[model samples]
Target: MPDGPHTAPAATPPLCEEEIARFVVERFLPGVDTGDLDPEYDLLATAVIDSLGVLHIVGWLSKQYGIVLPDRELASRNFRSVRTILATAERAAAVGAQP
Candidate 1:
């Protein structure tokens, strides 16, 4: 893992929870209130992000990892925290890898 603001991993696999958190905070949360953007932060409740932002994240995951997430899977549980996001991404990646 390359240090200094990790985005989705390129060679290895999908981004992990910690890397997702760093990416979201460093890339997406800039100019937003940092006080409410903790690791366990409820992104929806805090209004730290919206539905469009979740779509943006989904797009990024697809582009970066070739994991396309369908609209039906886009829910608050999947995008609520870094852990959840990584889990969702991993699931998508696994599905993509299947023959």
Candidate 2:
């Protein structure tokens, strides 16, 4: 009733590596300290994320950002580090923003 258009604002800001790290630590690794997480840390190399964990992260991202990742994009490289995940999320958000 107030304007020509009414669009919902994003629930959260553009995803960043630090925030992704915090998400990973809090949601996936409950006991892990935030300080222990590095933006460039190799989650897979360190056994931080196993096969099942990858699925969990994928599900979380889909729900959190309304993203739909393709099977080709679900490679280990994309989920290797928080930095990479942040980049992937940003890309997905950009794509989702288009009309």
User: How many clashes show up per model?
Assistant: 0, 0
lDDT score for candidate 2 against the true structure = 0.80
Q: Which parts of model 2 have CA positions greater than 4 angstroms off?
A: 1-10
TM-scores for candidates 1 onward, in order: 0.71, 0.76
1-99: candidate 2 lDDT, tens digit per residue: 776788897676445666678889987789988878878999999998987887888888887767777787788888998988877767776777889
Which residue pairs come into collision in candidate 1?
A: none
Tens digits of lDDT, candidate 1, 1-99: 666886674484437766576667766787654444566778777776688879878887876667898676798789987667888888877777889
Best by TM-score: 2
Clashing pairs in 2: none
Candidate 1: lDDT of 51?
A: 87
